[model samples]
Every structure is written in C-alpha cells, then in structure tokens.
Target chain A: MNKKGIIFIVFLILLVLHQDFWNWDNANLVFGFMPVGLFYHACYSLIAALFWGIVMKVAWPTELEEWAEADDSREGG
Target chain B: MSTVIVIAIYLGLLLALALFSKTLFRGTSKDYFVASHSIGPFMLLMSVFGTTMTAFALVGSTGKAFERGIGTYGLMASSSGLIHAACFLLIGIKIWAIGKRYGYVTQIQYFRARFETKAFGYLLFPILVLLVIPYLLIGIIGAGKTIAGVTGAKITPKGTIPGVFPEWTDNGAIPPWFTGLVISAVVLTYIFAGGSRAAAWANTFQTLVFMVMGILAFYLISDRLGGLGAAIEQAKESHKVRTLSSGGEVGTSQLTFLSYMFIPLSVGMFPHLFQHWLTAKSAKSFKLTVVAHPICIAIVWVPCVLIGVWATGIFPSGIPSGAILAKTVGVLVKDPIIVGLVTAGILAAIMSSLDSQFLCLGTMFTNDIVLHNSKKEYTDKQILSMARGFIIAIVIVTYIAALLLYERSVFDLAIWCFSGFAALTPLILAALYWKRATKVGAYSCVIAVFISWITFFTMSGFGGEYFVFGGIVPAAIMWFIGAGAMIIGSLMSRPPSEKTLAKFF
Candidate 1:
C-alpha cells in the first residue's frame, strides 16, 4: 500500500482504539492529579496532532497546490 | 459590579477592533461577505478556532465534566482534535477550491450550483436557519448564565439579595433577558460595522483572550483547591467518577461512549465553517488550522473540563452545571479584577463563535436566497445592506428566544443542536467525494435527518441520554439513517449531471 493508504489505516486504528471506555482496570491516577482514563485521552490528543500533521504532508493533493498557486496569481501574490 | 465592568470593557475592545477593521475594509460586498478571500494562515487558524470553540467548550464542558467525569475530554475533546483536522484536510480544502473557483459564498450556493436545482437551495435555507438559531441560543444563554452567576449579587440567608431590586432576578444574577440583550448588542455592533472581516479580526483577538484567561482560571481555581493533586483527591472523595462519562460510571458502556464520537463530526456540515473556509487566501492557509487546531483544542478544553471536575469536590452539595465555571471563579477567586477578567474570557469564547455564525447566516440569506431569486440584478451596495439588515433581524429573534428558553442546561441544548447537524454530515461528505450522489439523495438525507431528529428529540424529551437498541445514542441512530438514505437514494436516482461531476471531481 502507498504511504497515504498506510496513514488512513493508522487513523482507523487510532479511532478504534480511542473507544477505551472498557479499560476499567485503569481506575488509577497518573500523576497524583490525572485519572488514568483522562491521561490516556490527553496523550491521544498529542498523537492525533502528530499523525494529522504527517497526513497533511503525505496526502495533500497536487490539484490543491495548483489551485493555491492559481489563486495567488489572481490576488497578485 | 467589577465583573460587569470587565465584561463591558471586553465588549468595548471587540467593537474597537471591528471599527479598526472597517477602516481597512474595501467598499465591496466581497470584502463584507467573504473578506475578499484575503485572510492569511494565522488569521484563518484563529478565526476557525474561535468560531468552533463555542460556549459549549467552556461553560457546557466544565459543567458536564462536573457531572460525567474526565471522560468528557475523551468523549469530545480528544476525538475532536483528530476528527476536526481530518475534516479540514478532507472536506475544507476541497470545498474551498470549488468555492473560490465558482465565486460561491454560502453552502447553499455551492449545493445549488453542484446539484443544478434551485429547489434544494430553498429547502436547505430554512433548515440551516432553524439549526443555527439553536446554536445562537447556546451562546446567548451561556452569556446570560455566566453574567447572572457572577453579578447576580450574593444570596442572603433569605435566598434574596437584600436590596431594592429584589424583583430583578430569582437567582440574584443579572436577569437573563438583560444579559441576552447586552450580549446581542455587542456582537451585532461588531458584525454590523465590519462584516465578516470584522468578525475574523475580532475572533482572533477574543480567541487569544479566552485561551489565556481559561488557563489562568484553571491554575487559580486549582491552586485555591490546594493544588491539582488535592483537587483530584477531593473529587475522588465526593464524586469518584468525575473524569468524563455521560452520567455513567467510569466504565461507560462501550456503545454509549462511542456514540458521543459522532457529535464532533457535526463540524463537517457547519455552514459557518463553510463560509470561513471560503475566506481563505489560498489552500495553503488551511495548513496552520489543520496542524495547530488539535493543540488549541487541548489548551482550551482540558482546563475547562478539569475545572468542572474539580468543582464537583469543592461545591459538594452540587451546583447547577451551567453555573459551575462562573460560580467557581466567583466563589474561589476572591480578587474582583481576576473574577472580571476570567468571566470576560469565558464570554469571549462564547461571543467569538456567535459573530461568525451571525455573519454566515447573513451571507447565506443575501447570496443564496435573496440574490439567487431576485429577478432584477442588485448592486453590491444593496446586497451588503440586505445581509446586514437580515443579521439584525436574526439577532433580535435569537435574543428573544434565548430569554424565553434560557432555563435548560447549556450542555444538553448544545448536544441536541450538534446532533441535528451531525446527522447532516454524511450528505456533505457524499456531495464532495461521491460523483454518483444525486440531488434526490441529498433530499432524502435531509428528510431522514428531520424525521429522525424530531422522533429522537421528542422521544428524548428535548435532551439527555436517549439511547436506541439499549446503548447507541439518538444521534448515532439519526446519523446511520441519514447516511443510509443518502447512499440508497443516490443509487436509485439518476446520477448528477456529467457537467456537475466534472466540475467537482
């Protein structure tokens, strides 16, 4: 599979794993402050950010690049 | 009094920003409606971020976390960080290219062109208006509740503020109607003066204020509760499950927990977002929004949700969920200036979203309905005037509705509104990505949404954990039916024109 296809699969995996409600064994605190479940999601958010940034770099369409250049010219950029 | 003064000053600053943008405004309807499609990456990031972070994120999430626990972050914020960016990359940039190419300014305008049917535009206009009114109410009601909570005056032992103005409010907060009017007026002045350009500029400023102040409120409130560790312990003692489920235990049923995920998808169909997307200077402007948006969501939402959870332990007897944030600030943060600043920050989040929404609705009215149907050609000045006039009318109607229906929890009302929009997401996805998606399919999707939305809304008694098949949320049911209708109806009907398909694909 191509890199874009791999990124899509990774996103799917992340989505599936995000349903962590059944992780009841994690009723512990992470730092004496954060709940295990809450801490898990906080980590998930950062990972989500990193993965989406990669998707943008890998999957951004060439057509959109041409479109942006076209618009730039129209705006006298 | 200090809170009211601080909020007033914030409004003044917003209006000043609007006036400043007006000086820079080119005298054209293009600048008014879509900011002449000149917004840059950073400004686009701020505007889109501001427009999405509604009162729901601050007041509603905090209130919900107090009730549900930390799972509130997982249920919405964590997924939102991913889903929102995905939508921007997949949907936003594509539609923006189409819109910029076609000179379309509203979602309805794009649909009307893509489907080659004017009837669909008429059908969509009212539904969009109806959905947006509830959204407007979210901000208006939240502002009212926040202001009332902070400035309603302290309750004496008799449950009344011992003042001559005893009849002013039942809770001794500023009356909801008065608060609604003031908020409506402030948002209206900015939007009216500078249009979308003003809104974009003002939102960038308000977004910064609220984000900074949200962190401050979180830190101060946590410190007041004897640090974050003590706050968690207090919560675990008083409300063991205060992390983030729906009123469920930490082990929220897998199905029920998964359904909340559908709510974040509503952004895919948000008309205001469509208008904001069109304001991009180029497709490149979207990169910042897609990359930085998740982090921004984390910054704003984590603190609000944590504060709400902490409040559960601190106010053990229970506080109204809507008033949790304001009450925490009012009670725990003794410094009057700090209270005012924090309240202003909360209001900034609420109002930032409102201005964009108000401007988008106005743009739709003028572009999709008024101009699309007009037999005579209207001048640029006339078009601008119509959009502005319609916005004032909408602000009045929404303000009155807010005063009448300000009694529900902000969290519940916002969910019902999001559900209605979420059910419509599949239709937009098909419109953008599927060449076979027919006009009939879009119609069926709309019908499915209205039917399922009304049935579930009525069954749920307006709002609350109304599930189907023993676990799925009402929103999930509506979404499935809507998606099914879109796919089936498209297959059964004639495909969209070769012309339309070629244009979009």
Candidate 2:
C-alpha cells in the first residue's frame, strides 16, 4: 500500500483503540500511581502525537506549499 | 493581598507586551487582520495550542475529573489529541493555503468565494458569531470561576441574602462575573491596541505561563498529598467524592463518551482557529501544530485529571467542581505568592483563547460584512477603528452573557458551544472536499445546526449536560441531521458553478 493508504489505516486503528472497552472494568494501576484507565489514555495521547508526527514527515501535502511558494516567486520577479 | 499583587503584575506585563507589539504594527488592514501572514512555525504552534487550551482544558478539566472520576481524561483529552491533530492535518493546512493564495481573512470570505454566493455568507455569518459568543463565554466564565475560587471571602458578609451569593458561597469564593469583567478589560486593552499580532504574542507568553504553572501546581499538590501513589490510593479508599463505581469502571455512559468524539470536530469549524490558520507563514508551519498538539494536551491534561482525582481523596466532604483545582492549591500550597501565580496561570489558559476569539469576531465583522457591504476601500485608520469598536461591543455582550451563565459548568457549557460548531463542520468539510456541495446545501446544514442546537439548549435551560431522547448525546443527533440535510439539499438543488468547483477543487 502507498503511504497515504497506510496513514489512513493507522489512523483508523488509533481511533478504534481510543475506545478502550477492555480497560473499562480492569481497575488496575499502572506504574504504581496512575489509574489503569488514565494510564492507558495517557499512553494513547503520546502514541497519537507520535503517529501525527510521522504523518507530517511522510504524508504532508507539499503541493500546497510549493504552489504558494511558486506564486510568491513569480510575483516577486 | 500578595496573591492579588502577583496577578496584577502579570496583567501589567501583558499590557506592556501588547504596547510593544503595537510598535511593530504596519499601518495596513492586512497587517492588522492577519499580521501580514508572517507568523512562523514556533509562534504558530504556541499561538494555536495556547488558544485551544482555554480554562476548559485546565480548571475545567480538573473540576470535571473531580465530579466524573478518572475516565474524564480518556473521554476528552485522548480523543482530542488525535482528532485535533487530524483537523490540523486535513482542514487547517487546506484553509491556510487558500487564505495565503486568495488573501482571504475570514471563513466567510472563503465560503463566499467557494460557493459563489454572497447570500450564503449572509446566512452563515450570524450563526458563526452566535456560536462564537458562547465560546467567548466559556473563557470568561472560566476565568471568573478560577479567581472566585482563589479569592472568595473565607467568611460570609452579614445579610448578603439567603440562597443568593455570599450566603451560598460560604464554602469559599468570589463571583466569576466580576473577574470576567476585569480580565476581559485587560484582554480588550491589548487586542484593541495591537489586533491579531498582539493576540499572537500574548498567547505565546501566556501559554508558556499556564503550562509551567500547571506542572508546578501538580507537583506541589501531589507532594503535599503524600505523593502520587498515596494520593491515588487514598482516592480509591475514600470513595465519597469519587464518581467511580465499585468495579472501578471508568464510565457506564459509553454512548455519552462516544458522542464526545464528535466534540473535537468543533475545531474544524472554530472561527478563531480559522483566523489563526490564516496567520501561518507557510503551509509547512502547520507541521509543528499538528505533531506537537497531542503532546501539549497530555502535558496539561494528564496532570490536571490526576490532580482532580487526588482531590477526591483530599476534599472527601465534597467541593464544587468549578473550583476544585484552585481550592486544592489553596489548601495544599498555602503561600499567597505561589497561590497568586497559579491563579494567574489559570487565567493565562483562559485569556489566551479570548484574545483570538475577540479578534476573529472583529475580523469577520470588518472583512465579511462591513467592508464587503460598503464595497469601497477604507483607510487603515478607519479599518482599525471599526475592528476595535466591534470587538469592544462584542466583549460587552459576551460579558453580560457570561454573567447569566455564572452557574453553569464550564466543561458542559463549552461542550454545548462546541457541539453547535461540530455540527457545522459538514458545511466546511463538504465545501473543501465535496464537489457537489451547493450553496443551498450549505445553508441547509447551517440552519439545521442552529435550529436543533437551539431546541436542545432551550430544553436544557440554556446549557448543561443534556441528552436526546433514548439517553444519547444531542451532538450525535445534531451531527447526523446536518449531514443528511446537506446531502439531500445539494442533490435536489443546482450544483455550484463549474468555475467555483474548479477553483476549490
């Protein structure tokens, strides 16, 4: 699959994992302090942040920036 | 007194910064409205993140966690991290490119051009203003709540009236409305003088202040409560202030939580956010905002939710959720200087968003309605005066509205505001991606969003935790109503002009 396709799938996976029904009743603690549910979501926030960073690096639309820059240069000269 | 002194100093510094920004103001409407499109990546990141993290994220989140328990973090913060970034990646960058290309300053400008209808903008502008008014209310109300929590008199004054403030507020606090006025004045002073440029500069400074203070408050309170592990254990053991069930199920309202996923869609339509996007130096500037937003949310929210949860153990007798974070710091970290700084930090979180919202309202009024209607070039002085005058007018209106909503929960009030805009996302989404989206279709969506949102708001007595029939969130129904109306309205009516389609696509 192309990078765009992969990005889509990963985003979908992240969305699904965001609804953590499995952890709902677990009532466990993580790292001795945080509630298991809160801990899970904290990690989820980080992972989502990381995923978007990769998406920015890999899948960002350079066409938009290129078009804008090209227009600026054309106007300048 | 020391606490008051500290807050006063912070406000003074902000005023000075706004004056400094005014020194750099180029004498042009474009420069005033979009800062001549010169904001770079780091400032963009700080400004956007700062604007998004209002009192709703800090005091509001902690207060909510105190009432709702641990699941609050997962419900809003985790979901917002991914979804907000998704919005920046998908919608924000697109809008920025268009704004950069076309010199559009308001969303209505883009809509007017995209749909080939001035009438559509006419229908859309008031709805955007209406939705944003409540958003302004959230920050104003939140600032009041935080300050009142810190400064409400310890003992009630004599004969203050039963069931009316002072009597009912003896548990400790001042009025949120009073603080809202003072803070709004400070915000108005800066934005009035400096426009969008000053708002950006202040947001960068204020965002830094609030995030640092949030971490500091977290450490001091947790250390006071015998550290994080002990605090969590004590909260679990107490069970009085906690909303957790015996099984510790995060929440049984699975459907309500699911409905909240739609709330972050509001970001896609926030006029303030649109105005900020227009300030980006490049489409590439969005890369920082997209990547760093979720991490920023985690840094602010996880600590807040945990601190709120710890409050369950600390204030077992019960405390108002609005003041949970403030009260916790007051009791745990007792130095007035520290207290005042923390209060300022919370206000930083609240005020950062207000400046942009205020500026956007002014921008939309001047760019979309005033200038567009007049159809003549206005001088720089005229434009600046118009923007500033309209901003002050709206601030007065929002201040009054915030007073009436003094009793509402900041989180729930914000959700109601967000839900309206969230429902309107289909309008922008279809405008950007759907070639078949006609002006009629956009109108259908906006009108449907306004009507359904009003029905629900009125039913809930103007805004609180409300559900549609069958125990589902109102946003779920409103969102589908909008989508369905838009598709049907478009299919039945004429398509947009091919020229327009070619332009947008």
Displacement of residue A56 (Cα, Å) in model 2 is: 1.6
- Predicted candidate 2 versus true structure: per-residue lDDT over B5-123, tens digit per residue: 89989999988887799898886777778888888888899999998887877887887788777778877899999999999889999998888777788898888888778888788
- Over 4 Å off, model 2: A69-77, B155-178, B237-252, B400-412, B469-471
For model 2, state the Cα shift of residue B355 in Å: 0.7
Give the alpha carbon lDDT tens digit for every residue of A1-77 in model 2. Answer: 99989999988888889878777656567888887788888899999989998888887798988655434421100
TM-score of each: 0.93, 0.91
Each candidate's lDDT (Cα)? 0.81, 0.82
Residue B202, candidate 2: alpha-carbon lDDT: 93
Model 1, A1-77: lDDT tens per residue? 99877988998999987886455446677778877777788888888889888887877786874653333322110
Q: Which ten residues in a row have the lowest lDDT in candidate 2 chain B?
A: B155-164
Q: What share of the true interface contacts does each candidate keep?
A: 0.50, 0.57
lDDT of 2 at B387: 85
